[model samples]
Target: MLKDVFVVAATSFVALPALAQTCAFTMECYETEACQDTSFALTAELDDSKLVTDFGDLTVVGVKRDAPLITVFATGEGAEYLLSRNGDTARFTAHSNDGPTAITYLGTCEGEF
Candidate 1:
């Protein structure tokens, strides 16, 4: 019985982080130079260690689990993306690898799984 209790406690502890880090949304991206907005579906998986996305992957630099904001950086491409979620609304910003081409995306959270 003690071992079963430990197993259940450990499983819940390990699963909490994964559950907090998974989210999905659909976003309208506004590109600066293009002068147009495009829509895309994005799913983000952010663990304590790393952040993964559709366009590219980044290392989890910092995260506020309370505010549910994540700051992630690409490995060597000088790119960064910020994801912030508030209720069913989320905002995403992707910085370009070039000089000053940043894209801002406004999105609604589809669901979290």
Candidate 2:
């Protein structure tokens, strides 16, 4: 019985890598919310749960699954953001330094997580 359970568990873990995916998000900054002015294309590592942008690499702090929408929360040195995706379309928002300024990111995803 123990051997059978181990085999099943090992088989399940083997399939995890196949579920890992990477997504590219576009930064859409508002007039007042200037995220370095030119930093775009934030890469999301779905399997690794990491987001890479002009703020550098940020590890996902939490995740929320709301049916069609899946959201990941991440924080940087002075900024925090959430990336939420429904199918191919995704929306992202970030606030830094605890100020009122916030930046929004919008784009389409290519793979599944």
Candidate 3:
């Protein structure tokens, strides 16, 4: 009985880290110009509190657990972005620092890490 209990405890401990999973996403947005479109990729490391992408590294600041939304900020660029996940699809929106230059991203989940 003691051996079984220990095994269960060990399994739970190992699985605990997997509960905080990382997600990979591919995002695309259209530029201000009518014919321009930009594509990018990003990864959300929930356990590490980071959003990694080609643009720059963003620090995850807030999360809405009930709705599965993440708010991240980049200090160097003074940018704030919201990543909202709905099942297999996700929407990302970046707010402009100055004015009128915000971008919207539509993407799908690549997988979890």
**Candidate 1: where is the Cα deviation over 4 Å?**
1-17, 20-37, 65-76, 110-113
All candidates: TM-score:
0.58, 0.69, 0.65
Tell me, by lDDT, which candidate is best: 2
Q: Which regions of candidate 3 fall more than 4 Å away from where they truly are?
A: 15-35, 67-76
Error of 2 at 92 (Å): 1.4
Which number leads on TM-score? 2
Worst 10 residues of 2 by lDDT: 31-40
Q: What is the C-alpha RMSD of each candidate to the true structure, in Å?
A: 4.5, 4.2, 3.9
TM-score of 3: 0.65
Residue 89 error for model 3, in Å?
Answer: 2.5
What lDDT is reached at residue 85 by model 3? Answer: 69
Descending-TM-score candidate ranking: 2, 3, 1
Residue 88, candidate 3: how far off, in angstroms?
A: 2.4
